[model samples]
Target: MASPALALIVGTLFAQTARAATAWRFEPPSTSPTEQSGNYTGFSNDTINDTEVVEGKVFNRFVQIWLENTDFDDARTTPAWENLTSRGLLLSAFHGVTHPSEPNYLASIGGDFWGLQDDDYYHIPENISTVVDLLEDAGVSWATYQENMPTDHFYGSSYTSHNYLNASAEDYTFYVRKHNPLGVYDSVSQNKARQGRIRNFNDFANDIVNGSLSQWMFITPNMVNDAHDTTTDFAAAFIEYWLFPLLEDERFNDDGTIIVLSFDENETWDVQNHIYTLVLGNGLPEDLVGTTDDTFYTHFSLLSTVQANWGLKNLGRNDVNTTMSNVFDFVARETGFENTNVPEDARPLLNISGFAGPLNSESYIPFYAPDDLTAIGAGGQGVFVSDSLDTSVTYGSLGESTNLTSIDSQSPWIVVEDKSEAKVAVFAKEGNGAAPVTTNMLAAVSAAVIIAAAVYL
Candidate 1:
């Protein structure tokens, strides 16, 4: 038996301990902050110089709008997309890195998907640098504006769900964590200051009005607006409603600014993983409007183009080979389009055949086969194999042989396999967990725990 005061103090301390444990449980594991040398972290200590010029012009601002899931044909049918094409340069041969979606988003920023086959919460090692490192190194300010985000740096899934069939008439959670790549990486998530820079759309609007926009801006719309669940027409309408006005705004129309609009991946993976991509803004030459540039480009091109513009170092990934220099003349002049070819040894590994099941099927998991297992066959059922270099290989259930050596070439490949099952699981799990707490919140709770323990003693 204990005194009433002692019992009360112990109970309170136990409650505090439970709460602190809960907070720590939900919080992502933190890594040591990348060493900072000067104003930037994760870069060399040498003083950065930004003297490099692109196409005899230096762009001070780069803005990108990332849409979701709409194929090129469907996107082209949308009036809003047509309007943009009429005003900018459309890339006819642009393709996403792979399917279904998360890898493409990761590839766009990190330059390599790292064989990430699903959208599970991934805390990339801090040592794995991103475009943020390059931008920060060159003294360029950058931010990601996510529409419908619950908080400034909220790293959860869709806030809520509405019937996609009634998307136009109903309200739903637009902010999706998978679509916002920066939040997933430990390099940004573990850094309070860097995480703070990822603000909601309201902040983006305010920044625009206040003329306080960053040099680099990445914008992702809500599910409904970005066509993740809705039709392409719906997404186009949303873009028309929101983005058209910005084109007219002087802030985005300055000669030093460039705006890129693209999709994360296509609707179906059975066909080529081609997506519509366009470049517009004051930086585009007047003569190039309403024209289609057929340069072969991938998400890597976007990263490389930015690096070229800022004279930044590469992350030594796919960005080194697949840069879209010809698409952006500035990059082409500095580093010839053909000169940035991907090394034969550096191509991503391909997982040929195993199991192709529903995204929610128990068999589905985020598995990346070893790089050496380029052609594998097991389970003795539906066996499909193909790569970027060999486009004529037969696909479907195997009948006679799994021998693909005749069509397999040494050229760099982009394998578009069935990842929709994993994607479905990833999207369904969004916003399913507790919100993560900040460092200050953790520290305060820790101090409270210490005090409570002292009082109990």
Candidate 2:
């Protein structure tokens, strides 16, 4: 062997070379040449110009951590979660879109589930543009960090086996493709450049140390750590151990960084489909820490919040109407163009039956009906009406003098009985008809118009 001094020098030189090679630095792409050449070839130029004109909360980075299968009550009791809540903004009324986990994950990044209800290995078509497309168009970098994934861009139901139980028991590879929503989309999977961004969690540390972190980063823990195959305490411990350090790191905390920690869905379907959602980072105001925001939000709201901060266009889905306004103060004025308040009837009720796949069939048929509209008590004529903007009308059998609360509206209504059946209608203020047939019909018509506006506006 060579002398100790010589060996030490060689080792130091190798490490410096490695660091130099892997150092992550971001340089904004040069669009001046295209502009100078008089080649306004793509929509990016127009998007940049339009978005810059609007004043909004501009964030340097956004990081999201998605946990799995934990109820809001159970998750809040954990010390780790409680600690995070004390340091961040807690969303009390945040909810998930649906059950069985897959659709919620898809909705987080893709705006819509595309009618996905099961956890099968799905290949979404290329025509469907995800939030990744939006990020790229806005000149922002994005990536997905999944724990225990076999390698970068790994695409499969599970890393090793199709069966989750077998994979968890045999190899301890709990990385499931259902949790990796971006990997399933053809827009990302088919494109080599985008697929390369789906990296294992090990790369997260390397990127951080090398200063290569992207503008938008999505993180998914393994099944065991995320509480899917384990308990809430276990997931809590995992988060505290892994995330607390990053929160303290200057690389992630500097320059308006926002971190969102949320669960994919609730454990039980009987209660309101609320899940734990926490927003904490250096970007938030010091006074706002530990504040509770009781905003009616969903996964679509999270997507919209990011778009609002980055000045990106809506994906023309639920995100267009479901923007979260209460979290960021500047958001309300910036996103005035969007219909931030989603009507109570417009929201999809968590349908557990939606997860019921055919016994023998390989694929699941998407169920369109909302499960929250079950008949209750001795039924009469019941109509579920939208409180804000009179957009939706759902006619059903109502019980005797039942009080139904609108999800979006603070207005209260009491059911009254008519001769044939209890015709459910909006509660009149001073002097209004008991049940206005023409108004109810108009409400249905307005729903169609609002839906059209949501799609194209």
Candidate 3:
């Protein structure tokens, strides 16, 4: 007979192999840090919730629900927003990075908007990295949920009146790609598997039911529902239609989940750019319930907090800018990362628009190769340098050579139509006059991510 110790080890390995062979639609990467260091000399992998759950410092699941341009005062006085105050920690000083919408969404994930000051079309070069690159490298599961998104990885500028749920008004535009951040990146769009992961609410429902909810989730409601085309009360009605029941759903908000209810930016830009943000879910410490967190936070904090919680790398952009990249206090405290308290008077005037970056036609400056390799991120990890990065080039040379007029926003990310010879294709199409993108979206497929790590101490 086999020795008891050997049998035990065999049994554990067998169980892991079985779960990988079955039970999961996605497999984590072999580079998963959780499966490396913590996979050994410790208890079972802390990812008991789902294959995607990597066990962040303070929470296992993070769900960010982004509404649109309602100011702090406007949203706070609304019924749902008022009632929610007593349930979660309210962030009083969270502000948007810039005006309009797309860039703010881009800033949240990519760290910097790459000088994009307008809501117009843009596709950051594939060479530029984003949080998704870091999350996958570390073996974390992530996805976005766009309400009324016609199909997975739909590249349209906006999908109209496809309300299968019959939840929103008939005439409202259902989904807009501008509000969908990851889709804007060539890094994500060009990768077929990554494109399939940009899913609709139907997939969101299925993931919840299957208990395969991604550890990181971004949820964007329709234009009217997010308050972009409506009033504060209009958005409150959406909260009732959408968020209320989610609060009580275990699949959506288990004890380890934190759901962030925040706006992309404020409506009244002149008044200091503060937006109402609420941190809800069982993850909130009981003692801190109904409290107000005054720590200075911006959309970049979205990237930093996730990085800190998971011990992941940064994009080497604004994520290292300590001024704008303060991790959420709860996450910072738990992860041993410090956060700054920006005084109201000291806050950057975020409302003023135009000439903020290279995309600001009047202030156009070519992309600079950000000096990020040595810079430490909020997680205490160095910036993520792309494997495909041009090693031969120096920042000085590239900065001097770059031309704003010659750059194409969608050139590399979007495969040209008849110009297919100019670009490769999985499928090519455009939406809402969005710089040409994919008409042939990738179909949802299973993927595996298994890292070879010290399985036993």
Q: TM per model? A: 0.62, 0.62, 0.75
Which model scores highest in TM-score?
3
Candidate 3 yields a Cα-based lDDT of 0.68
Give the per-residue lDDT digits (tens) of candidate 2, residues 268-380.
Answer: 88866889988888876676689987657888877777776766755555565434322243343444423345454554575443422111012222111112333210111
User: Can you write out model 3's per-residue Cα lDDT over 163-195, one digit (the tens) per residue?
Assistant: 333434254465788899888877887688688
Stretches of candidate 2 exceeding 4 Å from the true structure: 1-56, 160-170, 322-330, 333-348, 351-457
Cα lDDT tens digits, model 1, 119-224, are 6454454544678876776677888877667566665555654433343545545566889889766578667868777776656555665566777888887766
lDDT of 1 at 308: 60
What is the model-wide C-alpha lDDT for candidate 2?
0.58
- Candidate 3 clashing pairs? 27-449, 28-449, 29-449, 30-450, 30-451, 156-431, 157-431, 157-432, 428-439, 429-439
Better of 2 and 3 by TM-score: 3
Segments of candidate 3 deviating more than 4 angstroms? 1-52, 162-172, 356-358, 391-457
Q: Give the TM-score of candidate 3.
A: 0.75
- Tell me the alpha-carbon RMSD of every candidate: 19.4, 21.0, 18.8
Q: 50, model 2: CA deviation in Å? A: 24
- Assess the local accuracy of residue 414 in candidate 3 as a C-alpha lDDT between 0 and 100: 26
Candidate structures ordered by TM-score, highest first:
3, 2, 1
